[model samples]
Target: DRVRIFSRRLTDVTDSIPEMVDYAKTKVKASEFLIEGEVIALGEGGKPVPFQDLMRRFRRVHGVEDMVEKIPLRLYLFDVLQCDGKTLIDLPYTERWEILASLAPTESLAPRIMTRDPKVVNDFMQAALKEGHEGLMAKSLTSDYAPGARGKKWFKIKPSDRLDVVIVAADWGSGRRVGWLSNYHLAVRDDTTGEYLVVGKTFKGLTDAEFDMITKRLQELKIRESKWTVHVKPEIVVEVAHNEIQKSPRYKSGFALRFARIAKFRDDKTPEEADTIQRLRKLYEKQFENKGRLLKEVP
Candidate 1:
């Protein structure tokens, strides 16, 4: 029996299963379907719920009924890949939408339609940023569904507010950084010239657990050793937050990143796909002009 149903991340449901069951009964056909959505927690005034609360829901395999009463969730559906015995992967996004829209009722349990219009997408991204969402995803309407494939068919536009860079080299930990592979040197690619240039470094954002996991992975990928640095295969991509960019002679590109902090490790991204030096130059220009305006306003 190939029944179709929608599934969301455990954290997204604000109501119990009984309530969702009732909602689903009215909204969907009695057939079996598997729908995917994100489960987020909501805060006061209809704000997105915290990740921690969502984690609790994920850990609860038993007592779901009781847990639902305690921890509510919000589901944001994005796609309908399969329905009954038919595969929606061969269908264009527009066709998929027709089936989904006709079948699924847009209520508290409904998922929002993701689009590719840059201007409209940008506006929605800004709203997501203000609402504390990590960022937005852009999918091409002509692309077929490719499960487990990191294809360009679905392009993610994460707030351009941060850079995902590769760890090219790392220095030995010292003092507090001792016993761990800290003090990283990050780099970005030159898409036009096929080169990598150092942009910044940081030793933050890794928990003890993360430290252990990354250290083990880094050691496995180690290629060469230097006096103060270990040159490893550039296999790790990390998201970084920065105050601004500046021109500098210390790096090959005549530029450097300032006040950089680790945001996250991007295991999904490849080193070759890291941001380019040209992109950095553009970002630096905007950051520099913004700083000048701030300085002028200061007393």
Candidate 2:
């Protein structure tokens, strides 16, 4: 009877049906059902727009009719979770897809192709990239759909430039964040040495709630402390976005992250599985060494 969108939880975004929401609801032929998909704002040339453009409309708390017209929304639905009064939990993914395709019209389905050829896969990836999509999802046909769980059956193949590092320590903040663990000390794992080495620190890219949550978490994992800094067990892994990598003797890793900021806390990964320092070194060589030499030659 009601249309819903599920990310980690059932979202509260569904209230009265707006233009796009109504459109989505109409696409579902089932009286009672759930579908999983990505919501994207279509830009010029029918390319999926960047997140910044979508955020403008997403933040609307009132009077969204104008915004809906300004930035039209599209739901790229891929999976069905329920139909009528029955749950499709135990069904194989291929069967679920067949069910969804039968119920929903062509407009609600994600663009997909069936083939195992490497050349065909490459060509599809190129086309997706051309359309400004992040990447493609490759799901095993036989695997059962597991809600909110990351499994080996589905793979999101996207461009990777960010590095995952664990938080080693944090400084108790000042002013507005006075009691919170504000600045996070990030580290990368040394696989050969079996140690986590400090690479850099960042206080950027966290919400106030995130700061409060991390403070409580780090305090529980606290191992040692100084006047301003509290060292913790290498437990919290964070993905960091940086401008580039540079050599540094400031830490045992001999590499540092430049203009680093927190992308997000990687709750999905453990410290042991966090990215290695060797990867940072390789990235530095690949992205910077030639550019550095070229800069010197410019003089």
Local distance difference test scores for all models: 0.67, 0.77
Candidate 2 structure quality by residue, lDDT tens digits, 138-174: 9888888787775998898765468999999999999
Give the per-residue lDDT digits (tens) of candidate 1, residues 11-129.
43333344455545666652756565565655444555434445555565567776665556565656677777787878887787677766676663343446557787778877776
What RMSD does each model have against the real structure? 14.3, 12.7
Per-model TM-score, in order, reads: 0.49, 0.56
Error of 1 at 198 (Å): 23
Q: TM-score for candidate 1, please give it.
A: 0.49
* Runs with alpha carbons beyond 4 Å of true place in candidate 1: 1-26, 108-117, 160-239, 242-299
Instruction: Tell me model 2's lDDT, rounded to 2 decimals.
Output: 0.77
